[model samples]
Target: MGFRENEINGINDLNLCDGEQAVNKTELIDHIATSADISKAAAARALDAMIDGVTTTLAKNDSVTLVGFGTFMVSERAARTGRNPRTKEEITIDAAKVPKFKAGKALKDAVN
Candidate 1:
């Protein structure tokens, strides 16, 4: 199955094929458990630990790079002026640090 440009409405429309569905955390945990021959609890714990590790590293303004997966890091967004739709008033948008992810070459290739 393929996606047409007009068919995509938003993130929720990402699964465009019949019998295809987005996999949630529980499904991921089940897959991990079956693949690793571990219990569901262990798989959940492992996933949580991995998430915590990435979060902690990003909190320190650092990056986490999985050789064939992706890199997660913090990116600084500059402050800017914006418009209010209702009032048509000018507003100042504050600068902030946001988390970003860049997929690695191997991950990109796998997807392609």
Candidate 2:
């Protein structure tokens, strides 16, 4: 199934990197289904599984590396003092562990 420009709903008019149109999760699911010759439901499940696995690993302070694709890791962000722009009031920003991604060489080269 394909969606014409007018068929999609609730999508933002946002241009992404290199001026390419932004693709949402639904579109990505469709692409995975088509490329892998799998049912849409299966593709969604696979995608969800990958996401859950990565999240679980990160939560454990570990990283996931898909050789040429990329690596998913977490980084510690130290707590800091921040200021409110409008009120000029000081605020406390708590430390947190943020997830990060680093693209591998092959993925970078494929894009370029």
Candidate 3:
């Protein structure tokens, strides 16, 4: 199947498909378990560990770049206005530090 056919790839895979990389979470767990020869629980833990580790690193405002895969960075989102569609009321969206990934060349090429 084409990479586009795999929705569970990750957020990165999704972006890459739309010229962006977006892979879903489940697929990561499956990949971790299948490739590591570990149980799903173990894989889940490992995946969580990786995510937590990255999150922690980013929390400190440090960037993590996994060579040949992608660079994970913390991005600051400016406060903005938002609307509640149901209530039809305006709201202030607070600024936030968000995790972002820029897919590496290898990953981009592989998808293509």
Candidate 4:
């Protein structure tokens, strides 16, 4: 089958699981086949390199600020308390390392 409705709705057409510019093997191949008019195998390697570059750089706590695109960073979430909506029970949320993105001013302006 192709991509599910929820898997692609309103998401970037270039970054769909089944559209193009996907992060997975099959989708990456599809993307390469279409966008760059490249062979599937070559596209796969390109996607791999892109993903590896992002992962290794982020691991070092360095922000990948794609000026006017956005900034990708790893941030620590301080431990905090939250309530379970269903049970209304208080719970302690453990601290976590999370990948975050803050769109640049240009992006925000474009969105608005």
Candidate 3 has a TM-score of 0.62
The alpha-carbon deviation from the true structure for residue 39 of candidate 1, after best TM-score superposition, in angstroms, is: 0.6
Superposed on all Cα atoms, the candidates' RMSDs to the truth, in angstroms, are 8.3, 7.5, 7.0, 6.9
User: Quick one: RMSD of model 2?
Assistant: 7.5
Alpha-carbon runs more than 4 Å astray in model 1: 1-21
Better-scoring candidate (lDDT), 2 or 4: 2
Estimate, for each residue in 42-65, the C-alpha lDDT of model 2 and write its tens digit.
Answer: 999999999999999999999999
lDDT agreement with native, every candidate: 0.79, 0.80, 0.76, 0.73
User: C-alpha displacement of 79 in model 3, angstroms?
Assistant: 1.0
The window of 10 residues in a row where model 4 has the poorest summed lDDT is 1-10
TM-score of every model versus the real structure: 0.79, 0.79, 0.62, 0.59
lDDT of 1 at 89: 100
Residue 7 Cα positional deviation in candidate 1, in Å, after optimal superposition: 29
* lDDT score for candidate 4 against the true structure: 0.73
Residue 97 alpha-carbon offset, candidate 4, angstroms: 1.7
Clash pairs (backbone) in predicted model 1: none
